[model samples]
Target: MKYPKIRELKEAIVSLLTPAYTSKFPAEPHVPFEKFRGKPSVDDENCVGCETCANVCPSHAITFTDDKEKGIRTIIRDYGKCIFCGQCEEHCITKKGVILSDKIYDMAVFDRSKSIEYQEKELLICQSCNAIITTREHLHFMHRKLGPKAFSSILNLNILNQKLRLAEGQDVSVEIKDGLKRKDMFNIICPNCLRVILVKYLSKGV
Candidate 1:
């Protein structure tokens, strides 16, 4: 028993002399390990303001506000409510739009507002109802992703081309094509109006 106690004491002394395995956080910069999910970052240039990140955020940390009168869409991300989940990064249409960064976790702030990040983009209005439909960049992104045939069934290519032209500040006119013209309106239609028109058109077998 005495020898066992002496051996235990010697082991404790050796441990005390050995280097610490625990990290000295705060005193020294703490580097996060590989695949560590930390803060989320958004690249506005690639984001297109799709609202996918806001919709997929499990913590409800991301929010979107649309100002129709001002033709602006505002996206807000609150790091204080973020759970460091990678959902936003995974579901982003453009992979480069959102990403989980390995940045240090020093998010302490005196004012809670300081932990919030905001981004704004211009909105595209419906040419018919004048309602805010989506962002200009988002329409362009969809056009690039889906190509000209994407909206062929629901919308005419000529109309879509006119919409793109209108987005570029070009003057264009809406002409009746294939006997399908809605008050000579072209460019874009609100979802509600589109649904109603599609239902009526389908019922007519045209």
Candidate 2:
């Protein structure tokens, strides 16, 4: 019948058509939408290690174990549990996109622990003035806030080098000893305090 012939013709045409979907695993990677939620990358220099991301994470994928005495904060990410919800990125206060990075879609490995890697180095604090000197991001942020002139006036080889320089035989180190402590002081002292500090230091010829 005519119906049988039409069905046979359709099937023949279908055989000539290309496959609808294909995976880009080995040769190429698939592109995600611009807003796609992926892995979180910390700009440790910018990150004060506030542990805000860890506290806000619904999945508990982020962990921060800070040693206040040492002024060291360790950040750990569990990729396996991360929902990629972008909560961390949203909460970061730094304007430099601290929690920003693309997810490796094809990042599969035998050991799950290896998938999580630490991107930041140990945040070394200034032992003398309790200022953040090691992190380029922190220094950049400070410079931006104070302006170039003030930055140069306040920070020179002498001041910069003295950040971690402790007065020998002192009972207690002069450094802040923790990012949280610095942040607390930061809350109390805004741009006004910075201006005042710069003016005072410049007048004293420090």
In model 2, how large is the Cα lDDT of residue 132? Answer: 39
Q: Show model 1 residue runs off by greater than 4 Å.
A: 1-12, 151-183, 194-206
The TM-score of candidate 2 is 0.52
Q: After superposition, how far is residue 189 of candidate 2 from its true place, in Å?
A: 16
| 63 Cα displacement, candidate 1 (Å) | 0.8
lDDT by candidate, in order shown: 0.76, 0.56
TM-score of each: 0.74, 0.52
Instruction: Write down the lDDT that model 2 would get.
Output: 0.56
Tell me the tens digit of each residue's lDDT in model 1 across 3-76.
99999999999999999988787687677888788888888899999899899899999999999777899999
Candidate 1 scores a C-alpha RMSD against the true structure in Å of 5.1
State the weakest 10-residue window (summed lDDT) of model 1. 171-180
